[model samples]
Target: MTSELIAALRARLGDERVSTAESVREQHSHGEGHHAPSMPAAVVFAQSTDDVAQTLALCNAHRVPLAAFGAGTSLEGHVNPPEGGISLDLSRMTELLSVNPQDMDCRVQAGITRQALNQILRDTGLFFPVDPGGEATIGGMCATRASGTAAVRYGTIRENVLGLTAVLADGRVMRTGGRVRKSATGYDLTHLLIGSEGTLGVITEIQLRLHPIPETIAAAVVQFETLSDAVATAIDILQFGVPIGRLELLDEVQMDASIRYSGLTGLRALPTLFLEFVGGPEAVREQIAVVEAIVSDRGGLGFDWHTDPDQRAALWRARHHAYWACLAYRPGYSAMTTDAIVPISVLAELVAGVKEDIAESGLTAPIVGHVGDGNFHTIILVPPTPEGLAQAWALDRKIVRRALALGGSCSGEHGIGLGKREFMADEHDPVALEVMRGFKKTMDPNGILNPGKML
Candidate 1:
């Protein structure tokens, strides 16, 4: 049966596009997560939306599972093909279909990487702002509803995506939403598919909203003696309307790891807040003043501000590399990073508790987050030993439970994928899970579209 399906796909897309080779199947089997790799039966490189539709049609007929593959940067097991069916690699479909600079939006094929899209928009004075650290495909970002430091100001992929063209499980092509900024449409299928993790449908094309390049941008690094102090200062700055483009918090352990990994000197190994302001020169200066005042009031020390593009990029690059730095602390051990968001009012307590939890667990994990949006991440290095894995899993669950207790989610940007599926029933009520299952069944009756993902 598998051979017949592969033969049919080869006939439709040519042998060059379809591959049952061991190497290709193994390459598409896993993502960056901690899950053990499992090879898919075959891999299909789709060149167009029509190709995706046809592939889905064939898979639907054969009852073969179909999994969408992007850059494979998923922190959870989002790209894993658990059922060992056909993995659809979308890299070949990369294309910037059209750019409407006047309307501040662009149409792009699902496989276009954020870096590539931003490069194409360099001369247009507009760029996409959703950066998930790694160069992830726009389709995967939309699928996971990804966000990053810029999310506080620009929102996540969910808000930036204006519309999407998707292929349903039944191989029907459907368009959701429109180019307009606002809509009161019936079902909001665009949002439904945004964070579906490719379980409901396969996104083929995306219309994304872009932001104009700011005239002046500045970044500031402020160090504090305590995590509570840093969190309190960040909350105060937000409350004072600082117009911060990006506000992130990194504990002393994370700062130390970053300094060692990047070989930087003169950085204090203390809890810190990394902030960026984007606007006119005057506005940026005003925002900086507000932030400085708040930090000073909260016992922050040595406020260093960088306005030069190169210097600012260097600082953010170090910040973005925090995860890698954390991993370097424990060589030969894989890192398990988890993100959670809490209310701004309780952020200080939450961060403080997390720091204590890590200390109690006797684990050397670094903490960082987009504090402006009340979201944070804990990067813990997990040894390959069975005991180490068990301890890491327990810590992950504990953090999720704590976040939920404090009116936050188990995951802020990372989707459920395979990692957090067990927490779905705990995060959402039974009724809510039922509603999600209803949507899943409605869109994928055969359960062949990334089965075992999310719900």
Candidate 2:
């Protein structure tokens, strides 16, 4: 049956486009997370919407599970197929279909990466602001409903995505929404697929709302004597309506790793806030003044603001490389990153408790977060031993349970691909989970689309 499936895919997509090669299968077997890799029976590169529809049709007919692959950067194991079948490679379908400058929106194939789209829009003074700190394809971002530091001011993928084109489980082509800003119409199906994690269907194209380049952008890095002080400052800034473009937090350990790895100097190895304010020069200055007062009241160190474009880029460049820096702290160890979010009022409590837990566990975990919105991550590095794995998983679950107890989510940006499936029941009501399963059954009755993920 496996051989028959491979032959059928090769016949339709051409031999070069479909492959059963061991190396190719291995490449599509996992994402960036720590989930165990499972090789697919075959990998098919879909270069167009028609190509995706045809592949889905064949998979549906054969009752073979199908998983979509983009840049393979999902940290929740969204692209991995625990049950072996066809891995639909969509990175080749990258095309900027149309750009409506007047409407501040654009259309593109799912395979286009966020950086690629922003680069294409540079000349037009518009950019796609969803930066997940990796070379993540837009389709994968939509699939997981990803966000980044910019999410605080701009918003996550859920808000930026205007519409999408997808291929349903049974091979029928589907399109939802349009350039119109909002619709009061029936069931918002576009949103249903945005964060579905590809269990319902394969997203082929996306129409994204864009933001204009800020007239004056300034970045600042400030340190705090204590983690509580740093988090309090972040909370206060937001409460006061600072309108900062980005607000990030890095614990002392992460700051040390980042400083050493990124070759940055003069930053004290302490709990810190990396902030960016956007607007006209005067407006940015006023926001900075307001933020400085809040930070000072919370015992934050003096702000070091960067106005030069090169300096500002250098600051964020070091931040975007944070995960790599944290991993470098312990060579030959795997990092199982955890994502947890809480209300701003409880973020300080959560971070403080998690830090003490990591120290008590004797783990080398560096923390970083988009603290403006009360979302944070911990890169827990552990050796490749049974005991090490056990310790890491336990620490991860501890943090997750604490977040849920504090009216938070097990995941903020990372979707429940395989890692957080167990916590779905804990994080959501049983009825919510059942309704989701019902939706899955309705869309892909055969359970041939990305099985063993989400539900």
Candidate 3:
């Protein structure tokens, strides 16, 4: 059946666009996660929306399972083809469809990456704010409902995406939402597809909201003798309505890893907060002043400041590389990373509990997060043994339970995908899961769209 389907794909998309080659299949098998690879029978690269529609039509007709692949930087198994069929590679569909500077919105093909879009908008004094570290495709970011450091101010992909062009499981192209900021329209299917992770359909184009690049941007790094002081300072700033552009926390382990990984000439590896403020010069200065006083009250050390673009960029560079830094912190060890978010009130407690769990489990895990929004992540280093893997999962569950107990969620930004699917029931109501399954069945009746994901 796969052979017949492959032949059909080649006939439609040309032989060069369809591949059953071993190397290509292997490349399309998995993402950046530690999940074991499940190679698809074929990889089909789509160059246009029409190409996607036609290929999806073929797959649906053949009842051949298909998984969408974008920038392929997903940390979970969002791109893995567990039930091998066609790995629909959309990386070639990199076209900027439209940009409306007046309306502060733009449309682009699913394959255009975050960096590419921002680069295109660089001269316009406007930028897309969703920065989920990595050269992640805008479509992939939309699919995952990704959020990052600046999310506290500008919002996540969910909030910024104004519309989507999605090809359903049956190859029907549907456009949802529009350029308007608010609409009292139908079922809001745009949001339904966002964070759906391609389970219901393949997103081919996205209409995204854009924000003006700030007139003045300032970054500061503050170290604390205790994690409590660093966290408290962050919490106070958020609670005080600072509208901070970015607030990131790095525990001692993560700070140490980042110091070595990103190079630091005059900084200590203590519990640290990397902060940013963006607005008019006066507004940024005021925000920084308020945060500075808060930090000083909490006994935070040297408020190393930098308004220079190069210095600010370097600071974020280190924060973004925390994952790789943690991996390097324990050479020859696999890292299992988890993201759990709690209410601001309970974030400190949750972090303390997570620290305790890491110690009790005897694992080396570095913690980093955009804690201004109460989401934190830990990269747990594990041995290359079955016992190590089991221990990592056990710790993950403990962290999830802690968050849930605090009236938070199992996953803050990372979607369920293949990693957090088991925790769906634990996080959501049974009725919610049933409704999600209904939506899935209604959309992809043949179950060929990203099977065995989410609900």
The sequence of per-residue lDDT tens digits that candidate 3 reaches over residues 1-455 is 77888888899889999999999999999988778899999999999888999999999999999999997888779889999999999999888898888888899999999888888999888999988867899889888889999999999999998888999998999999988999998899999999999898999999899999999999999999998888888889989999999999999989899899999657877999999999999999899889888988999886877799999888898988888898888888987878899999999999989999999999999999989889999888988899999999899889988998999988888888898888788777989989999999999999999998877
For 1-455, candidate 2 gives per-residue lDDT tens digits of 66777788888889999988999999999999888999999899999999999999988888889999989999888888988999999999889999989899999999999988988999998999989988999999999999999999999999999889999999999999988999898788899998899999999999999988999999999999999999989999999988999999999999999998998788988999999999999999999999988888888878778799988898899999999998888888988999999999999999999998898888899999899989999999987799999999999999999999999999999889998999888877999989999999999999998898987
46-69 per-residue lDDT for model 1 (tens digits):
989999999999999999998999
TM per candidate comes to 0.98, 0.99, 0.98
List per-prediction Cα lDDT, in the order shown.
0.90, 0.92, 0.90
> Which residues of candidate 1, in runs, are more than 4 Å off?
none
Candidate 3 worst ten-residue window by lDDT: 261-270
Q: What's the candidate order when arranged by decreasing lDDT?
A: 2, 3, 1
Return whichever of 1 and 2 wins on TM-score: 2
lDDT of model 1 at position 45: 95
Global CA lDDT of candidate 3, please?
0.90
For model 2, the local distance difference test gives 0.92
Q: Which regions in candidate 3 have their CA more than 4 angstroms from the true location?
A: none
Of candidate 2, the 10-residue stretch with the lowest lDDT total is 1-10
How many steric overlaps are in each model, in order? 0, 0, 0
